[model samples]
Target: MQLIQLNLKHCRAAQDLLMQTVRERGSEVAILSEPYRTGNSQGWATDRTGKAALWLCGIGAQQMCDIKAADGFVRANVCGTWLYSCYLASSLSLESFGRILDELSIDLRGHCNAVVGGDFNAWAIE
Candidate 1:
């Protein structure tokens, strides 16, 4: 399946450009973080806080086995493989980040084929 991942940064222009590019590239799925809420969000699977979302088109939606959304994460099972879009904000405390990762790891432990992509905000200070 053709999938593309990006961080929209809540910008409408970036969102537009991404959609146009997705169409041009014939991408079947879009995994995004920090998306613009004012834009089209109809059938997307979005996190509780709307920090993460993923759009499935045509066969991508049909192949979905399970879907789950959390505060900073959105996950979908497509074609028997798990796809995850996550946003780990740099402002969050280290303990909180560790907890979130522990939970996600527990879920991932049962699956073998998986792809994870997103902005963890892990850029170095130096």
Candidate 2:
């Protein structure tokens, strides 16, 4: 299975670029941060149509697995593999992010396979 991760900057143009990449790469799962939105930058904007975002074509509603989205993360369970899409703001401290990871580790205890991807612009990867 192919997984793709992108920071879309919450714009139509970015979403389009994501789609183009998806097509070119034949990605089965996409972890997108900062998808299209008009206002609130505090939360995610779920493509309400159930598929596609702004101008980007999605994997299609019928093709989607069990997915859930919360404040700083989105998750999907597909065929025994769990997908965790996380986005941490640059302003959020590493300690706080560590706490979040701890919580997630607990939640992921039983899962054998998981794909964790996202934009961690907060960290300086030395």
Candidate 3:
């Protein structure tokens, strides 16, 4: 049930650090955005889109949805809870982010117990 989310900024060293920390914390899942990918990371669930990745340490997950960069999201069912990892690029406008949110909600329609995590660079500080 424990989850940690991080924006690696595409650093290999950061990926190593993240793995170490996850194991030390005994976290069941790690949600990553902008992960550094050389080829296929051993435990991380990577998709063709490559915007977000999910790692399940000891727990098994059943994927409910396909990972896509168009919405920047990946979904899986973990022990009855719907888990999602998403990433929103800073270059995208708030409206785009909102649109993605709407799309995600559509995918989440029937799932009551769901957890969504990711690095969203979009923020309204103005």
Which one is best on lDDT?
Answer: 1
- Give the whole-model CA lDDT for all candidates, comma-separated: 0.79, 0.59, 0.74
Cα lDDT for residue 123, candidate 3: 69
Q: Specify the highest-TM-score model's number.
A: 1
Question: Deviation in angstroms for 66 in model 3?
Answer: 7.7
Model 3 per-residue lDDT tens digits across residues 37-71: 63354445653468777777644453334333346
Please give each candidate's TM-score.
0.86, 0.67, 0.78
Candidate 2 lDDT, 1-126, residue by residue in tens? 676777777679877777688788777666666666432322223332222221113353323355555545656665567777676677777787787667667766886788777666765679
Worst 10-residue lDDT window, candidate 1: 56-65
Error of 1 at 39 (Å): 7.7
Task: Give the winner by TM-score: 2 or 3.
Answer: 3
Which parts of model 3 have CA positions greater than 4 angstroms off? 38-43, 46-48, 59-70
Report the lDDT tens digits of candidate 1 across residue range 19-61. 7888888888788999886335444787677888877743444
Arranged by TM-score, best first: 1, 3, 2
Q: What clash count goes with each model? A: 0, 0, 0
Query: Candidate 2 — worst ten consecutive residues by lDDT sum?
Result: 48-57
The better-scoring model by lDDT among 2 and 3 is: 3
